[model samples]
Target: MFNLSYKAQRYLILFGFLTIPVVLSLMFSYYPAFSLLYYSFTDWTGLGWEMHWVGFANYKEVFTRPEIFSVFEHNAYYFVGGLIQTAVALFFAVILTGKLKGRNVFRAMLFLPYVLHSVAIVIMFKNVYHSEYGSLNLFLQSIGLGSWQQEWLGNPHLVNVSLAFISVWKFFGLSMVIFIGALQSIPADLYEAAKIDGASGWQAFRFITVPSIRSVIEMMMILTLTGALEAFDIPYIMMLGANGTDTFVSKTVDMAFKFQQAGLASAMAVVLLLIVMFFIFIQRKLLFRGGE
Candidate 1:
């Protein structure tokens, strides 16, 4: 009877401990998310006490609209561009982890951009990339590459690329830090063994460093992909005053606030959610399998 009382008391204590967070999460997070999912299928204008059932109409509109599709394409550009940045960060991480001079100072310098306010960073880049009276153009003209200077953000063909370059600059520091941690966690004896086996540095990296950091790389890839998909702040701030650039790349904020098309904006949000889920599914299959 005493043992049973003790067991029951222990179970009660554990349940008492978890019940608060569980209730709070259900009330705050889970319920709101579920409400959003339900609202996505309805024509809820985000105001008013009434909603209309619309089935898949919102999704259909999202797919049939070229502007919306362009948003997806721009998001894809971000994904690919972030991956390139992550790769470059990993390279730098490897070098910094090696016997390099003033490595800590270099790492701190590289990471400084990430700590700055994103709006400030974008504004700084805006000045740098200005078509007239800009430093970039001035330097280009000085070097006889005058023809190479162009309105970077104004050109439709280059706007997304410009945003991507800024994103890479702001985010590469995070990837570098992650990669450095992963590199440090690797056992040095493995590298020494490969060296004793006459493996070149590249060969050692391929077989030792790459495989050892595979899990960390996968985690960073997932984070980068999600961050890119939901990118809003930098592009929003940069393209605020522009006109006729209302492609998917620039209309997200306007669709939500300026136009007050809450249902449509909710639909866009849902599409973004599905994209993240798809990537997560793919990551689970390709990267998280076999307990790695």
Candidate 2:
């Protein structure tokens, strides 16, 4: 060690610290990922080693079927729902950051659900959406809006929207928190300067608030896009992916576990991964490249 240069000593220590994580990552992450890719080309029931190569058959099935493609459409509903959630969150964040009474309490109340378990939330909403005795139907009856109430979960047409609402309720708080942080990072003097220039509230918000937080909004869009595409849990738990509520990830799980078709599930997974990666690439090029 005494004979080694100072830079060499630092490099050696850094290599020692990275060794465990690098080895673990290769064993756990990379190994399973490559295995999934390989499994996509084979006929495996996920229960045995005796499997035969069946290249592209599963991929062909995934791309050809309308029922499977409907899951992709459901994913788009989730994405649109997230955009609505983002807009609502942004509105709340903007108001909360302004000089208003009890804003902290309001923020805390709004953010409460973001910290709750998603499964628990899903279970709770499952009951809330019940057609017969659910709170939603009961409330509508109380308000003389009984005609407006329909089967929130039972019907195929309303199931996706109902589930999407649940997702928005769960996630908007998180979006609000992210927007709050982004709003705080914006310079107060900009608003002050705008006000001095006789800017209206709407004008300041449109020009200053929106433009300044462009990057954060772009980040949220990417996140929501990916999250919506990969949505599984709430729909799975609430509807078991039934009645137009099935999404890409939920369908993948059903295929792999319920039907014991690991090869087809792997193909679905690979296709979904490619779609997500392609969107990420587009967002990176347009929104994130060469800048913070």
Candidate 3:
């Protein structure tokens, strides 16, 4: 028998305990994803014991089909909407982190949305966007902007945009909180030093604040991209059972459960996963390459 040092034996025991949960978690979490990837190349309907391997048929179909293309386009729209919302959150975060009154109150209010259940929020917004008796249309009419009132989530043309608005409202609070935390972590001494060196407010922000919070900004960007790519709940709940508006952005769950096209849905899921991984890789390369 081989004898190990006391430190080495302790390390082995610690590693065993720590690695057990990690191994179990990976099995449960990643096994489904791997199964999805495998099923994407098959003709499985997510039922029965029989499944035929179809190779790249799913991928070929997704690319050649107009509906799939439309879904991808709507996904792009979702990503853009998320980006705009993140920008708005960053703006508000900067203001709240600066010398301002009632900053804590504002932060709490902004963070309130993030703590609510997403389904509840979506249901609430659905009523709010109703065409006739909705608060939004009523407010528009009261403000003499009745011409702007239209079927928000019902109109095919405006459905995506309307969903985007709700997505922003629900998610911007999280980005704002993240940005606020990042901004606060930045030292005030840096700003003071810049001031003493005759730097303007804008210059200080550009050089000191932005640079100091680069890592957090990068992390948030990755998170926003992933969230946008996987966005399903709001769009699905908003446009449930609606025709014409059942494009790619709102068809993922329906494709799997309603149509029983599990293979195709899994293919689309794989594509979305690839997109998220690509963005994460690009962000890592660009933002986290050096120890700056």
Maximum-TM-score candidate: 2
Candidate 1 vs candidate 3: the TM-score winner is: 3
Candidate 2's TM-score: 0.93
Score candidate 3 by lDDT.
0.81
What lDDT does the true structure give each of the candidates? 0.82, 0.90, 0.81
Model 1 agreement with the true structure over 147-249: per-residue lDDT tens digits: 9998988887887788888889998888898899999999999999999999999999998998898888888888887887777778778886253333353
lDDT tens per residue, model 2, 246-287: 888988998999999999999999999999999999988976
Which has the better TM-score: candidate 2, or candidate 3?
2
What CA RMSD would candidate 1 show?
A: 3.3
Off by over 4 Å in 1: 1-17, 241-252, 286-292
Worst 10 residues of 1 by lDDT: 241-250
Give the RMSD in angstroms, all C-alphas superposed, for model 2. 2.2
Tens digits of per-residue lDDT for model 3, 95-210:
99988999999998988887888789888987888997888899999999999998987777887877877878888899999999899898889888999999998898898888
| Superior candidate under TM-score, 1 versus 2 | 2
Per-candidate TM vs. native?
0.87, 0.93, 0.89
Clashing pairs in 3: none
Candidate 2: residue 100 lDDT (0-100): 97
